[model samples]
Target chain A: MSKTLISARGLRKSYGKRNSKFEALRGVTLNIHEGESVAIIGKSGSGKSTLMHLLALLDKPTRGEITLNGHPTARLRAHKLNTIRNKKFGFVFQSFFMNANDTVLNNVILPLKIAGVGYRERHRRAVSALKTVDLDDKRNNKASDLSGGQKQRVCIARAIVNDPKVIFADEPTGNLDSATGEKIINLLFKLNREKGITLIIVTHDQDLANKCERQINIKDGRIVSDTSADAEQDDDGDEEIREIIAESEEDDDEDATPDKFEGDNNIDGMLDQKHPVHHINIDEDEEDL
Target chain B: MKFLDIIRDANANLLRNKLRSFLTILAIFIGSFSIISTSAIQAGVNNFIDQQVDSYGGEGYLAVVSKDSFDALEGLTGAMGNGNSTPIEYKEDKIQDGMTPITNEQLDKIKKIDGIDGDSLVEQKSLNISYVSSKKTDKKYLIGAEALPPGNIKVETTTSGQLDLQGDEYQIQLEKKYVDVLGYTEENIIGEKIQLVVVDQFKHTQKTFNVKVVGVIAPGVISMGYSYVNNKTADDIYTENTKYYPAEYKDHVVAIAVNYDYKNHSAKEIKDKLEDIGLSAMTIDDIIGSIKTFFDVILTVFKIFGFIALLAAAIGIINTLFMSVQERTREIGLDKALGMSSARVFLSFSIEAISLGFWGSVFGITVSMILGNIANNIFHAEGGFLESFPSFNLATYTIKDIIIVTVLIMFISFLAGTLPARRAASKNPIDALRYE
Candidate 1:
């Protein structure tokens, strides 16, 4: 497994009356691996989104520490935080909060723009990103003119355009129709698979949670079940997995691109398993040659 | 962010409310324009006064009131009585034994004074008479006369036979206007022909002297001050007003030219000195009563106008800036979040106001120039009072006008922007982000 890139210990956020502090995240702790795809699952007010915000350094913890890529985040200056946010993190909110006044092309180029990207190169990258979302023809269309689903897709393009190390989505499908939501999820995972970029998503949808290799269920900001799909059941031997499985050297092809084995290599309902050894072997084979 | 982005974004935002922006700029333009125009006109008046004074030789000489000089006689009728009063209803038929005349000795004494450049003595015959030709004409008194002084005063009379006033000065240099008109009344008046009957109370001289109309001398805008009068003792006593002397007539009115080299000086010093010598001197400033007084009435009217216009312009600026603040609330929030200080926000808005003011002043000045020129030409064509004298020129050019207008506009804009910019900058980023 990759080293932990971010860790939040006892993170909490509260809102409301002076005497009544309605804690959003009550002592939440979570770890995101360097390149892992992790999904946080819970019903409404489960503190999943709050936890994501804390992890992304978008919110400060009221009573705890949030360390991002190994550096403590609470004491960071605003300029330094902005720089880190610009270069390291990308966001895909549920509503795809696009600036309604600008064209799709401008929206796609906004992050690069805030980074002071040159006009020509910025447009070129923006166009390429739009093409990736299959919305290149609509690049000049105002964001207000786009449908809910199309806007979300464009937002995803904007997020990945910077080639950031982590893409954090807060209920990436909360606003879209069922089919469109599924499409966005598929697109997100596909891009994650292709780029080996970390994807941290928080969602209430069980179907979405079923797809990620690791699932964390937050019950009152405490991670009640942080079980991996096949983690030897923490010495108690329990997994929803009918089967279990998964998984650098910068060179020598040891951590090279995971090649396609050219077969019906499907890993579905793989979260249920008795022993995780056999799936672990497949991960090892997937590692190098 | 790139500089271009900031410019383009600002332009785009400003475009959303074009009327507001234009009105803002218009306020600036009018404000700056009025200021420059007002200043230029003030400059014009100053220039005019200076030109009028300078055109008549220099400013050192004063018109004084010596008890025996001719001006004292005229000024004594000023309702302000002379030192110790005796109304001289008529000229003294004879030089009284006790009477003081400004004599040649006094002139010589003045010549001995350290700074006496020169002097001129004057006599005047201010009486009116009538003449009937085949028709008739109004009896115009000698419209103008030069009171010649001592031979040492160097009276330059342009009379017949080249009788140099330096060598053989005459009684008067009469204008040919009288002789030329005499031809209509009498016959063959040009040369060796006509005579004028000279009469002025106790005086009737009908001796037909040869009409030596040597030259027509008219005092123009620039005339030399070398004219002088011969001593009264030099003239033969020919019974009051019937004498044609070989030397210039004794006008018995003295003018002392004090040698002052400075442009601006205390006239009181010279006056006090003259007063010690039993002469009363009044400076140019005393005569004109300070150039600033000429502006009192006009300035009062103009200041009221300027005040009202400036107030309106200020309102325009404040309104536009407040709108800008409201429109760019989120953008300002974003900037603040990016660690921009409130002062930077203030500076940006203030600079924008200055820019608006700057352009307006340029336009205003252009209007003033074009309009001022048109006014001058029209007034001159109509033979108006301003046209009769001359113009005060303080011409400005493209570079100079631009620089001046820009500065004025920006300064006023800076003044106008203060409250608005402060209000905008004071908003907290958190509230501003949530602001509509």
Candidate 2:
């Protein structure tokens, strides 16, 4: 097996106070090897996003430890974490959160700029990253003026500008149609294959998950099935597990309608519990079927 | 992130909301304009006053009088207006009516003072002139004239020549207004003789003495419209005016002008030594200190108003930045997620505030300078208040004051920015990213 780049043990995350506490992740322990394309699949509120956040070190777990490159990350200072994230990881979100008023080149320069790269060198790297995504010609154009696909391509350029060891993508193509989504997926996979950059994607799309080399399915904060573990079994067993994942997704969709109202209230309560003044709440309800 | 990148992004973000940023800058501009303008005016006034001080016998010059005489003069002026002191009790030993003369004993002691230049002492005598007349005009005008004080004194003049204090010939530095009335231009008046008629009050007789015009004196507050004459002219005129009086009365000296070592000894030290001999001394500052105090009070009030305006501007900075922080929540999240440190996030916002201050103060200094020059020109034009005083500028700009104001305003802006910057820096990345 390839060397493990990241490993987690008994990861748990909970939101709010003791009485109204919601455990997003109960106990998720996993290991991701170098250069692997992995997809974490789950419906809304299944804690797939929370698990991804912990593994990416974007957040700390309530009762767990995460190790990156065999070194414990729990005791690291905020400055070290920021430096690690800046130099080693890149992220892509569904909304392509870019400075809309800025040019595409500046948008792609964000990561390199954060890493404090020299002006000319960062510019050259950003341009080269843009070339990788085949959007070099549109670099000077305003980010807001671009189409959704082009904007996502620019976001991808930003992600790879620092030459990160791992790229964490959260619903990278959720806002794009299938044709545009396929192109984005291909680009991400191409980076994974050619540059040997690890890809960790969090999504509810089964087709997108199936395309990845490994798939981890989460349900109610627990790992239900992992395709890598099933790979040791027969081919028929792998097919059966895939069928089970699809049926469970269908069951979640059926169960979602009634739980939608309660889930929204829970989000509101969670927002109040976390930051009453900011009103920063996750829109988990919108991600459901 | 690099500091330069933070600054660049800060300026870019400000441009994203031009109108809002402009209004905040406008508020700061008002404060800076008022402050810098007042400072310029204060500097101009100080420059003019310093020039006047130089025209008067300069740093070491002192006017010595008997303590009783100085107190009486003060009492008279105090009664006339500005009643700041209580009425003095009538003391038998103090002179109640007129000025007390500096006795020969006091004069001898004054000459003995450590820093006093004994040879520079000249008895102050009022010249009783009947009238001044030039041959070209055939018209005589009443005039007040006094001898130029001892030591190296340069009277500010419209024309070139200086009075020869020790000249054997009667030399006079005529006032500017007298030059035109005497039918001579400032240039043509040089080396020409003018008649100074001194009249005897008892005998009712007049003696006309011809004094050469050396220079035309510039109009100034300290000169008080008095023409300057050499010692020969003043002594002859005084002798003629008091021809019928007793010898003792002729020698009675009310005041004396003297110079001291100002660099080695302060004016107060000399004054204290003179006071020990029952005499009072007034330095140039004591003579003109009231005018300075008046200007200082007015300028201080104006500065206070400027600070109030700056306080309001600081609030405006806080308000503008808070709104900006709220608007750029998602962008800040993306920056933080991209690994921009919390301190850098705070710095970016602080830089935005500083940029606002920079632009505001720069605009303020530029516009105020333009307007100050325009005002100076207007005040110095014909029929304007400052037209008569050509040496006085109504506004002055110094590089030190400009730099100080810019740094001060920028610091206030940074302080005002801290509130919003801290809010931006402390924002949790996940929550901010999820904030739709």
Candidate 3:
């Protein structure tokens, strides 16, 4: 609940030639609050992934205005964008895209490495991030050898290694089993609560979308809907959000209402007893890894 | 950021692809090998040539007649080029009494000529040589090679007993080993009393002096590339005693040293003028040129061999460069995408090619030297080559050839880098990246 951290307006992306131009994203505007847990959900190819990619600075927009923190990314140089991405953004992919040659610790520590942190310090920081995903024991193991779920956990650890302000997950649970998917979802929301880290995910699964505090849906190349999960508890800060995802059942043109992901902050009831945490810190600054 | 780190990392990368690097460097090794080995052999040949030429002083040299020497040798040899060129026999023919009447007047005039630095009219008075060594009884097939004044014989073989003592008509460079002897070895047994027999216009033996053993000479000393060499013809024939017919012989030969003033006129200029005065002038060039047709054949054979080696090395270099480009495809793409110019890539590979050639040359040179030495040791060139026939000095190239070889190698390196450097510059960034 603070000033907007990101605001996108008139974003667009297209592929192919003029006559057969396949538009990935059309003009869309949205605002995201500080430390907000937001998920954009729709059926596959509804411009959800393109939205995430644009927000993540992985690719430039064909035509758009996207402001992160406060600066416009309309024409930032590749090196400058890489610097911002390294210092402020993190990503987790459905395929668990970790470099096979690197150890679990090294994969987690890459962002900080790109940020030019010292070797000893990066190692120490990466170890701590590994602990976050309960994968400290597998620190020296090569990322390539990890199981599917374990690989996802390693990716989660890497996303948080540099203490990034924004963590983006593009179909984070698409490859995991049902039980593993629930665990990962629980972990994402836990970080949003305890550490006040911003979270954004692009998913086609409606069940996964219902778990987030807010959902922004896209149809064709345009935003079709944006709303909370709880229709009546939009005012009270303690609004309960149980998973209400209807992902694969949605149509391209269906209007999506935002899903409420927050629960009562004082009880910690919704979370498993296994989860552990401390005071929340939502500072705009980042800690060096 | 760190220079040493960059080289270390590059070196490690090179080590990772050991086979590729070795194959690449092998081209250089072969190229340098060809250049170096050939040069070493050339050096050996030149060294041998120098030993032969060293005995003749410098370049090619000769002394001959255009007309006649005496009735026996009249026109038995080739002429000195022109129809009326000076005959060298006249210089000796014109000399009578104790003075060269025509030469004293032209001594300064000869000096004023364009390429004539100095000249000597030599007289060799053959004395019956005696060995004082008690082990000898009328033995030794050697003569004290004696001559007079600035007049000297070209003693190609230093082992010969060419006496170096002071004597009128006897300035000899005796082989150091045969100094003082009062008798003869069995080889020279006409008589034991080694003395000079002086005679007048009448047929008579003016046996004046019983010469002490001031000198003796070894027989085998002439095997060092000599035009006029002898090994004790006959002790009695040249003794200070008898002759088949009576005559007062005052004949001499001319030995001229040509001035190295190559920029000015030639010695042939004065040689032409010498004929009018009944004199002759011959140069080392004429002597060396007489056998030039033979040398041309040798040069043609060596050139073909050297060309083959050089061509093979070039092909090796081209192969290495192409492979290197293939291996670094992704790296090249990354560099290009990151703003590296193709020219820089070309330059880098060019340097590599040049270095490869250089190291190859070095190795080749070394191997050649070893080969040369082995060959020399195995087939010792008996001193007969120069001593027997027309032998040329082979050391120290004409300076022109030295410059030629240097320019040749540099040009070869440039040629070797040709295709490789171009291929490196021809890579496309997008295509190369997609090569994975």
Candidate 4:
């Protein structure tokens, strides 16, 4: 099985202090493996964004710990955290945050600039990233002058410019029309499949959640349902079998329906076996049943 | 972020709101202009005074007088313009007319003092010359001439050679005005002889002494338009004028010019020693120090105004930067979220302030220099106030003052920037992103 890129256990997050304190996340336990496209599905205020923030190392958890590549991130200094965020992770926000007055190429160059890349090399990398998004022609155009879809594409270019290992997208298509959103979704999955980059997307859209290999539904800061646990018993035995299935699935690439449900099934099964506590937490939160 | 990137971004940010930045820089320019202009003017005045001091017998030379005579001179000047002031009472011990002579005992003590160059001592005797004439013109002109002091004395001259202090030949450095009146141009008069007639007071008999013209003196406030003569010529002329007086009165010296070891002892130290011997001494600074003090007072007042303007400019920097911080809240949040450190954000803002100061001071210095040069040219031209003093510059810019002003203004800008920079650094990325 692929190595776990990020693992969290009993993570909790809160805001304010004492009487006015509020809990954003009670406890979330999950493991995201390398190259897996996982969707964290939830409504607003469900703490899915908070979980993503902790998993991406953009913030510190109030309780418990998160380990990136088996190193406990809680003990790392702020500077180290910033370096990790800059080098190892990418982010695509829903609002498409950008320096609007700057050129599109400059917006994409932000992450590489922060990493202290040389000017010529960073420019080269930014142009290549923009090419990947098919927006290289707009390199010199002001970011504000672009359409909403183009702006999101430019934001995606900025996200991947530093060659990050993981891309945490906070509602990547939240502001787009369905037609443009589908194109963005296709591009994200294409990068995941081609470059082997792990994708952790936080979204409420059911259609988008179903497109990923695994869907973890968060309700009131607790994971209520995770589809990966149902096939836990077949994890070790199914790796070789799943590879055969994956090979055959690649043959019928145009048939999107069957591939969506069955793709990477064994990979999800491996998750529940290693982390029994995550399964137990889901069982305990199933009081509605 | 790299430091260069932070600085570039800072300058770029300033351009985003060009009008506001320009106005802030304008305020800073006002303060810098006034300050640097004053410093330049002060430097120019000091340069002119230093030249004057060098011409008047230099740093080591002092004019020594008996303490009583010095005090009586001060009293006489003080008693003027006030009719109510009492007249001096007669005293048997003190000289009645305030012209007390330096006794032979005091003269002996003066020569014995440490650091005093005994050979450099020359009594400042006023020679009563009847009139001066040159062979080119029969016209006799009234002229005042004194013996040149000892040591490295460089009298400002239009055209001249050094005066030989011990030369037996009588040498005179005639003033520019007398050069024309005696029918000799400055260039052609060198090596020529002029006649100085000294008439005895009692006998009314005259002895004409021929003195060679060595140099032409440039007009200066310190020289007072008086020509300088060599020691031999001055001694002969004094002897001829006072030949009939009592032999004891011949040595009644009121003042003497002397040189001392200026490198080993300060002028004040030597003055103190002279004071102990019942004598008073005035250094070159003591004589012309009032001019410097007057300029210093006026310059200091202008400098105070400059600082006050700077204080106001500092407040303007704070206000401008604060508004910038507020306007760029979301942009700052984006940078912070993208992993730009709090310190870097603070640095970027601080750099913006420094850039403002840098531009302001650069503009101030450039404009002031241009204006100063123009003023110098205008004043040095014909019919200008400074026309007579060709060697005097109205303004002088030194590299040290330029650096000092730039550094000081930038430092003040950084101090002013701290308030807004702290605000920017302390902003929470999440909250800042949420800001509209």
Predicted model with the maximum DockQ:
2
Candidate 1 runs further than 4 Å off = A9-26, A37-63, A93-99, A153-163, A168-172, A200-289, B47-257, B263-317, B321-324, B327-377, B380-405, B411-436
What tens digits encode model 3's per-residue C-alpha lDDT throughout B1-436?
1233233333444455568656655654554445444444455455544444455354323242322232213232324343343334445544332223334445455555555445432223344443222234344334333332232334453233343333333222333343335344333422233333245324553443333332223223233211121222222224433353334332232232334243465556556755554555455545454454455466556656766766776777677667777877755653443233566556656666665555555555556556655555444456634332223323223344434544465467657777877876677643454465
DockQ of each: 0.11, 0.41, 0.06, 0.28
**TM-score of predicted model 4?**
0.89
Between prediction 2 and prediction 4, the one with superior lDDT is 2
True-structure lDDT of candidate 2: 0.84
Per-residue lDDT tens digits for candidate 3, residues A1-289, read 4768887767778878999998887665677777877778765666777777778765567876789877798878755666666667777767665666558987787566546577688889989988998999999998889888889989888888878788888778777777788788888887878888888987766566666667777666565557632212222221122112224334322334443334432224534333322211222111100
Q: What is the TM-score of each candidate against the true structure?
A: 0.61, 0.89, 0.50, 0.89
lDDT, candidate 3, at A76 = 82
Q: Each candidate: what lDDT?
A: 0.57, 0.84, 0.55, 0.83
List the candidate 2 regions with Cα displacement exceeding 4 Å.
A229-289, B55-57, B84-97, B246-248
Instruction: Give lDDT tens digits, candidate 4, residues A1-289.
Output: 5788898877788989999998877766778888988888766676788888789776788987899999999999878887888888888888888899999999999988888888999999999999999999999999999998999999889989988899988888777887788778778888888888899998776567666778776655665456664322212333455445535544433222222344455433533232211111112211110
Report how far residue B161 has shifted in candidate 1, in Å: 28
**Winner on DockQ (2 vs 3):** 2
Q: Which ten residues in a row have the lowest lDDT in candidate 2 chain B?
A: B87-96
lDDT of 1 at B150: 23
Kindly list the per-residue Cα lDDT of model 4 for residues B1-436, writing each as its tens digit: 7789878988998899999999999999999999999999999999888888776557788899999888777767768855454556668766568778888898898888899998889899897888999898999988898888765677888896878878999999888888888887889999999999887889999799989999999988688888899889999888887889977677789999899999999888999999998899988788789999999999999999999999999999999999999999988887777787888889999999999998899999999999999999999999989998999998999999999999999999999999999999888766786687
Docking class of 4: acceptable
lDDT per residue for candidate 1 within B1-436, as digits (tens), equals 6656654665555556788878776776666566566666665665555544443334555554455554445546543654565554445543442224445655565545444444432222321222212122444333333333222222222233222343342323334344455343212321232222234334454332222233332222221322211223123222234344323334543444344323444566655655666665555555455554766457546745755676687778788888788877766764553334566667667766765666566677778778767766665565664543345443223455457656755687788888888987787654464465
